[model samples]
Target: MALTFHTGEVGVSRAEVTSIVADALRREAFTEALVATYVWGKGKRGTPRGSGPATLQKILAAEGLDVALAAAVTVLHEHGSQEAYAALHQQIPELGPSFFTKFLYFTGKTLPPANGPEPLILDRVLSLRLRSLAVTVGRETGHDPDGSVAAWVWADWNWSPHRYGIYLSFMHAAARQLAGTDSWPSDAAPDLLECALFNSAWEPSS
Candidate 1:
């Protein structure tokens, strides 16, 4: 569905979703990308969550909204350090790690990060999943034997750039490991792993 970012009006037609994203990527249109990603991510919950002209106005009015997005574009296209890219974005209000990460994920569809895994959405679900793994690993290793470091690093929200760096590194590693298995395609993108984890398939269900 097409989205009017200035007004936050949801457009008709499910088929437009792909086309809108395609158009955004084709032209590197930040506004269109913002609309497409936000609409696509919110899906059915947009309207009830107070997605309207007023809310959208607030979003657009946020100081450094445009500047931050511009920096994101540079980071994505130039393959700048992902941790610094993440740190650059954390200051923007109205856009959090969850949503802004979606924007990053969409914008970077054309180029993989130079030094690490491409940006993937790191919402609450994925963070908690990481938290569980951290707790387990902490238990096994003396480094975080009490899981306190795990809790601090993998908190449900407001993750630091260092933590984001760790997350990207881990996701890429997990993606590589999954590719080695018969069930996963060798060329599958890391975001596919992000999707799987978000869809209730975190780790092997054992």
Candidate 2:
């Protein structure tokens, strides 16, 4: 069966999704925002929660940027292992789920997996969109839509280390199929598939 995505207006071809993703990737402001978030641990525009960049700067100051970076790398290396994730939370008790996840996202973007897809941003918008996709993909693949993986990613708000590993696997498969060709745009990257999905879900229909 050919893999496809619903563009919220009509069923969009993979080629169209790839084109939208590619165009988004080429935007200077988009790339700059990602860069700023990765380097500074939060962009100047602030988080989805409305917390300012200054808050992130304060956390970095308190945690020691180098130490925080090392911890973040360790968490990614472990592939979001429960132990590693816990250790990070313990190290920075003040960072709630939203901020911690963002921190992980930025670090993962900075140092992507050597063998697999990079860690995806899991903000509220993306998470909600992914939840919907999980149901669609699960049904298409004949998997239980409300199973552990889906529950972990879609139902639960807190990051589950074990489930996140499963979620990443699903994301990799979906992204590869969506790319539709061997030569996908380098700048776009597979992780941006979530961005494309988010756009489909929330962008005003034209």
Candidate 3:
């Protein structure tokens, strides 16, 4: 099956998700709010709790809606909880619908079609899909044959510098391992190490 990028809705992209989260962190403190909201909801509130839209707007203004959305996605995807989902929805309503649906379609429905791309041969070191690192990808570099596009699609575009650094480090390590540089041949060791040392980080998982 041919790869079809979901372009129907102007809903959240992975880059948007990362951006919202990163901006929220830099603003006031959505992380703390998120934790508090989660705890409060879990206790006795039983949903539809906290400062509501006004307070959420404050958080969004401090951070930015896009940033907040990204943060919410991270919280839900990484943590994986009904409460997390609730926490996110308590802020951004669209996420539970369109954004998440796109995410599901990519991860659950489209992975096999994606993985059909040819493997990255040594001499033909094409772009590697970042989703394969986190979820799944066909085979072409970063998800498609184009490295730049893959990076744009898969790297956490919304993370803070520190968070981005940490993520990049992991990606670098993963690339090295996937490319068979972890145990390079004597004559080719240095080249592999050089490629491994490159920034090798960008994009958001799509």
Candidate 4:
């Protein structure tokens, strides 16, 4: 089996990508807990409560924290993505790319309803795995995979409307490929694929 790329290109697919995610989802342990945290403001062991950045801060905040920061977080939780981004930009101007992207993920997860596009988490694990897949495809095809889609993600593109659109498009493509399959849970193709990629990247080496 070959994993399809954004440009309609194909690379040899690793079976473990699907298998690990499927196995994890079948157990419904870690994955379910994470989903619960995202859907509801409930913490699970190491995972904190709240899905959005500000909401997450509010959930994790201790007693007698900065009053202003707490107020800002409350405002961020109440608004949509654009407002949340603006709030984050003003509050945490020094935040890095990863934080911004994760903020987007959490915002998407919390704001959207069940039938909406499942938020794809673009953390270090997922990014590294995606780059590795791109490298594999490049080696096989003798063409640099640092094209638009790959560059937008792997090159650390900033969070913008255009970048977010590209990211959603890529996830939607992957979801379409994995749709209507029993490899994981139903109606969660994108997230299932993302979990598979993350697990394959982060799994301990023997």
Candidate 5:
């Protein structure tokens, strides 16, 4: 299906875009993959392109982008490593974890093995969910009983790499937990859970 923007503009169909991005990744066309991810995903929103495309242009033209993207691919699809994740954190100029992690998440979909936990989107919505859970757990455990710290850590944007790693692990674990159940499939991707949390409310179990 095509992801039509709120502006009533028709873009490429979802399957076509996914194939294009997957081919780009297989060809080591990181810049194209990144651009396709944004244009097809967030950029489709009615919001102005802003500095996003310009920033991407500058970063993609730089020499070190290949190294960063390559390492990200290796870690995300080949080895599934936190060390590489740390190294990739904010490596791209003007690109933050929120955006780059989306790239990684899409890459995980196109690529296989994941070698371990698959990468998934961790935008503000997902972080907010995590924050709510952290706060609830903290209250129950008497740690950060006021949830002040939890809210601070799970801010709307620019999360630290360590926190990003925590999100990946948490999401993958939750996906596994939901799988093989009555409603969730045994082979469901973690992104499914991420999307669910993004669209719903989170509350601590009593």
Candidate 6:
């Protein structure tokens, strides 16, 4: 089946962005550290092109890991045109060039697992604090935050050529956002991988 394309420019407001970013930070305590990720999935297998990955590496090689980490998340939140770009470029020849490639450059290499699921084909993460704010924004904007935001981590191991590379997929609203870890005792002690902006408003399709 052919895919549908969204015409006209899609824009988001700065106030909304600030609200979303702030909420993501407030409700959820910023993660002190998250294990580096690695790609593991099915799809084309080829070393990144000339100076492509290298350029991205240098551009993103921030002095502080925290800045790098935040930038990573920000990229996802902003340039999440993976699906759209793929579909549109086919029709709009000019847009087909290297949009995806550039986007990937902005994103860095996925690191190896931290020590959780064995075949963690994908890992979608989000800040618990952001959940409330997103929910609030969604409500105020008449848009569904759950529908708009979420993480997608994927790895494919069945592609014809490259069969052993980590792939990240945007898993829509599929993370479990908890409070904190167990050993380290504190007020918020639950680990949240994903949390919906507002649970009451969202109902599962039965």
Write one digit per residue (lDDT tens) for candidate 5, span 83-125.
4466578787766666676677677667753565666666666
lDDT of 3 by residue, 5-110 (tens): 3323244443444444345445645443343332222222222223344443444344345565455444444543222233334355422221222222222121
Model 6: residues >4 Å from true position, as ranges? Answer: 1-24, 27-29, 33-63, 81-206
Q: How close is candidate 1 to the true structure, as a TM-score?
A: 0.77
**What is the C-alpha lDDT profile of model 1 across 19-49, one tens digit per residue?**
5655776675666666667666665322223
Report the C-alpha lDDT of model 2 over 1-206, residue by residue, as the tens digit: 22232222234433443344334334523322222443333332124553454454455455444465455556565655333444455455345444555444544544454444566545555566667666667766878655556556575355565545565676667666656455455345555666566566322222
Assess every candidate by TM-score. Answer: 0.77, 0.53, 0.19, 0.45, 0.77, 0.19
Model 4 misplaced regions, further than 4 Å: 1-91, 113-118, 145-153, 156-161, 182-186, 201-206
| Per-residue alpha-carbon lDDT of candidate 4 for residues 66-172, written as tens digits (9 for 90 to 100) | 33233323343464434433443334333333444443444344334233343445544456667677666665676864544555456543355444445556777
Clashing pairs in 5: none
Once all C-alphas are superposed, what RMSD does model 2 give against the true structure? 12.4
Worst 10 residues of 3 by lDDT: 117-126
lDDT of 4 at 115: 39
Off by over 4 Å in 1: 1-19, 25-28, 44-56, 81-84, 142-145
Q: Output the number of the lDDT-best candidate.
A: 5
Ranking by lDDT: 5, 1, 2, 4, 3, 6
Clashes of each: 1, 0, 23, 0, 0, 38
Worst 10 residues of 4 by lDDT: 41-50
Lowest lDDT block of 10, candidate 6:
35-44
Considering lDDT, which of the candidate structures 3 and 6 is the better prediction for this target?
3
